[model samples]
Target: MTATIHRLGRDQAPSLEPMMALVAEDMNSVNAVILDRMQSRIPLIPELAGHLIAGGGKRMRPMLTLASARLLDYSGTRHHKLSAAVEFIHTATLLHDDVVDGSGLRRGRKTANIIWGNSASVLVGDFLFSRSFELMVEDGSLKVLKILSNASAVIAEGEVNQLTAQRRIDTDEEQYLEIIGAKTAALFAAACRIAAVVAERDEKQEQALDAYGRNLGIAFQLVDDALDYESDGATMGKDAGDDFRDGKVTLPVILAYARGSADDRAFWKAAISGHRISDEDLTHATGLLRSTGAIADTLARARHYGQRAIDALGMFGNGKAKAALIEAVEFAIARAY
Candidate 1:
């Protein structure tokens, strides 16, 4: 088993540089497709979409598609356009999510919804969704289309699920996992699964890639959840207590609530019920999270999933692509550190 790499030493910190180098050429092609496809007669379509699209995201989903192809030793360029399509799907979700969450910042910058208003952001997101379908149709693979389209639907369902659970202090760990699996991990799985389809690989190989992506996605989300409470805004790329202020019952909060004292539980109920959103309350919440070991254990859960993601690649032969993907999992966990 490939052990989970810790980020205790900054000098040896895991980074995305390896994956970026591995996918540089193919990612360039995907970027060209993205730039060309984002153009439109209506100025706002491209402008608003570009604002978030060009935002400093790692483009992790599309990169997964490209890397998965390389892992299978695929030489064809079919995954390029599909990779752009995967990115478009991801960008569309981000735009809609910012609007729904009423988020003001992303990547340490103003969210599209904040700059263009909610309606514009949502409309532009719909435009991007249409663009993604066009790209998928151009790829002309029914399997790819089914995988991505189903992921899209599942993502929306997950968003809705989270919305319903929002501000409700009663949400549990199981429900939280289901929501993240749908909203975040669904596309990650689809991105890698479609690569196997385009590569003409066997079903077993496809399933392996899907599991790899899914577990990695879950680990990534878990880390982000921990960071929400453990990191500063500069490190988190957004507000530090955004999840807490918004009453999101992520795993850290779930664990803390379950293990909290009577007084602590009452505090959580009040904080999550939207009554304690001040800086002092957030400080208290953070102190509680630390005292109960919620944040550390949340990261432990992330390591568990990260290990699963690394192990999923066991059947693949050792090479640059496989090593990069493994490091990618390490980087995901290291983000919290």
Candidate 2:
């Protein structure tokens, strides 16, 4: 609760330059293919999918798909299909997450649940989830299907576990990692893994990509948690202190509480456990995080994961694509709101 959101000024993070270039290189064709594949058997399905698809996400997942494939020297067009598949899976989860969390806003706009209702959001999410499977099966690659299915299952199970464990002060970093891995990292892993799989990469290269994605996902979510404390809804596209408001425990607050003075720790116990965070108390908590360096420590951990993600690609040879992937690791941690 002590974490203060940090919004970036006009200076954009330099790390994104290479990744942005890669995105521009292939984004148009990739998006075209993705849009073409979104045609649904059910009319409402397309509408629901369209609502989420048009919401203007970073398209980070699909970009990773293309980048990975290109890095492995895949000149074929099948990567576009796999990229769309990865996007569908990601969008499906967002729909379901909004519904489960009862969140009203995402990315500074009304959530699907707010516009279409939870029932619609949940059902449409199911539709998208099924559609992703159908698309992958059409590709007729057993490896792709297996990897994506496993990721899907883990994402669902992770959300369920997080729901059950909400607001528990005792949640450790291990438990935190497990929950985020399933909920966030699984698709990142799958997206990267599928690229190597489709390219028929060697085992060592495949493993490297997997490690990169897994560590990148962890770093991404950790930074996400940090931003929740420091960013406003307009900038971050979500409510500030959303985790705290939802009675969820995240890293900054966890670290702060662990290192706080008796009274500072008691404030968290009372505010979180007894449900007593007021506007006044929120200001006090932010100050505590600044004073205690909990935010800095959590950011340091995210930096470590970010570096690991870059290091995972050391085995790969030189190329703009590989450099872009490496730059993405830095971008993941350094993004400002």
Q: What are the candidates' C-alpha RMSDs?
A: 2.3, 5.7
| Model 2: residues with Cα > 4 Å off, grouped in runs | 1-12, 15-17, 23-25, 41-43
Worst 10 residues of 2 by lDDT: 1-10
Pairs with steric clashes in candidate 2: 4-230, 5-229, 5-230, 5-231, 6-230, 108-237
In model 2, the Cα lDDT at residue 222 comes to 90
Among all windows of ten consecutive residues in candidate 1, which has the lowest summed lDDT?
Answer: 2-11
> Against the unseen true structure, what C-alpha lDDT does each candidate score?
0.92, 0.80
- Residue lDDT tens for model 1, 240-315: 8999999999999999999999999999999999999999999999999999999999999999998898888878
lDDT of 2 by residue, 1-337 (tens): 3532222222655476687687575767778866777776777777777877887788888888888887888877777777788898999899989988889888788888888788888888877777778888888899899989999999999999888768777777888889988999888978898889889988788788888898899989998988877778888988887777676777888888888999988887776663756767767777777788877877888888877887788777777888788778777777633
Model 1, residue 226: displacement in angstroms? Answer: 0.6
Q: What is the TM-score of each candidate against the true structure?
A: 0.97, 0.92
Error of 2 at 234 (Å): 1.6
